[model samples]
Target: MDTEAHVTERDRSSDPDTREGEGSRSARFLDAPWRRPALLGTACAAFLLLFSTFVMQPFLIPSGSMEPTLRVGDRVLVNKLAYRFDSVPQRGDVVVFDGTGSFVREEPAGNPVTGLVRWAAAAVGLAEPAETDYIKRVVGVGGDRVVCCDKRGRVEVNGRAVDETYLYPGDVPSRVPFDIVVPQGTLWVMGDHRSHSRDSRDHLGEPGGGMVPVGKVVGRADWIGWPVGRWSSLERPDAFGRVTAPGPVGSHG
Candidate 1:
């Protein structure tokens, strides 16, 4: 009788339904009310982080340089892959790029924690972009001759005048006249709000001769994504259509 009783107890312990009940109690301990929401929040954050890093990134306009097109406090979507696959920036395209060693002679250094905080803020358009990032419109590409204020008071590309209807009202193409032949694999960029912009014109005497390298380009601004009322797709202006391919090096326009 004692042996039979012990066997019965052991069989009950080994039964599948009994084991399942024990497992259910263990799962119940972890199924707290807060767990689901916390898990969901974590998942959403990770998705947004990935999306921002690899796909389209949102950049906040911090200056009036691109006025009449991109206003201060506006959020623009930068297409990071625009030039990644053997493509290059075209004239009249608005682009974002890291300016270290080009637009900026020195790269700023900061503490890790502060950098992290600023990065977080900039990622969501709450803070201005870092000192290294700049936005401007391409005016001349490699081999192009860019001359400011032709006989008609307009900027010229390869000896052709550009009708810049997009310029800020009453703003001239450039107050300071300039003539430059863009070197190969670089670009000459400028701002629509010429008076307020410190672009290639301002860095003419610096190294690289005010030309932004093609490799340093971050992406093209494809759209204004925030401030719903101001949202619109960015298109290349037709003013550049009349410009011809750049002449050979040393050829005067």
Candidate 2:
């Protein structure tokens, strides 16, 4: 990924002067932000664009992959700085990531015009995420042993069972059985609505072993921001509080 490209794009969108690369609109926008032509809507869009670029970004839920916790069309507030200052992602945190290599081999090439259109709309939570973007809950983080269904049909991490109260009703922890140690700097993530989500479980046989690298994470989802009535905090469940991270080979015994 071109890190500088994303940074440059954010700079251009946030600063009207640097927006010259965007075409003639920069000239008109700089003069009177809301005066002639496009009116108030243009100014509002610019403010939202700036906010989304630097602060919390609104992400529209594209499917029922997260279900009861996050419904379709629910706009989520992604805290961009949550993991920026040497903060590591923990188990039970919801995160959005670029799933190119781990979730899918690579992002398919698309026309620049169409891709631009999608990016513009998706920026403000009006459209689905880009082809490689995905959101899921972190089940196991770097070096933890993750297993499915220990007698009670609950997922276990580092030998502790996880009580997933957020899971969609009637769904089991996992229908398929597997036991694997999450690699360092990667996450074993899954969706709340597991049956409907194609997360780490589905990619168990693929390269990277379905672990999403911490570097690929965009940010942690802290709240749901839209639909007026459906707003709420996406809390980190406490079920993992007693669980422990993996220790060196001989340390545990």
Candidate 3:
């Protein structure tokens, strides 16, 4: 009788219903119809995020520094690969460059976790860039003489007068006079909205004299990607047409 009672107790404790319940929970996930699609969506989103942060990023215009060309809130697609093969940024090309140690006064902030979030947001064109970055037109390349207010009140590159029809309407080349030759392997850049922009000109008296190194360039702004109404392709302006290349020994004038 005691043996039969022990057997009954073991059967009760090892009931099949309890075992089935555990099995069902384990199988529930496998049986879900939406699992595959959800996983695929997450994978695609992650891939896009990675591609944008480390590869090609979309930068938003927060200020009117590049007005008439890039407005406030406009998002531009930055081509990070453009300068990887080349060693310099060409004149008339709008470029996005890292301003951490060179241009801006404050250094960039954020820990690893926060930086990843910010980078992901910037990749999808939803957030502002974290680093001190600037979008400016390349006025002078390495060894080019870039001077302001020539005889025609225009900015000169290599002693040639550039017709800046692309300048903001009624805007002059510069109100703060400046004359400096761009150093070799560096770039002198300026914003379209010269009056409001704090470009290399603003830093002329600072440490680097506002010249950005070729290595600091992040990418070229290839297109305005957001705000469908403002969508457009960014092209190198032809104003540098008559400008001559630097001489073998560099520009003497």
Per-candidate Cα lDDT values, in order, are 0.90, 0.89, 0.85
Preferred candidate (TM-score higher): 1 or 3: 1
Candidate 1: tens digits of C-alpha lDDT, residues 35-139: 889999989877866776667789999889999988998999988889987999999999999898889988888999999888867766678889999999999
Over 4 Å off, model 1: 1-30
- State in Å the error of residue 193, model 1: 0.5
Question: Per-residue lDDT tens digits of candidate 3, residues 178-206?
Answer: 87887887899999988888899988988
Report the lDDT tens digits of candidate 2 across residue range 50-91.
888677788999889898889998999998899987998999
Question: What are the clash counts of all predictions, listed in order?
Answer: 0, 0, 0
Which of the numbered candidates is closest to the native, going by highest TM-score?
1
**Candidate that scores best on lDDT:** 1
* lDDT for position 72 in model 1: 90
Report the error of model 1 at residue 90, Å. Answer: 0.3
lDDT value for candidate 3? 0.85
lDDT comparing candidate 1 with the true structure: 0.90
Superior candidate under TM-score, 2 versus 3: 3
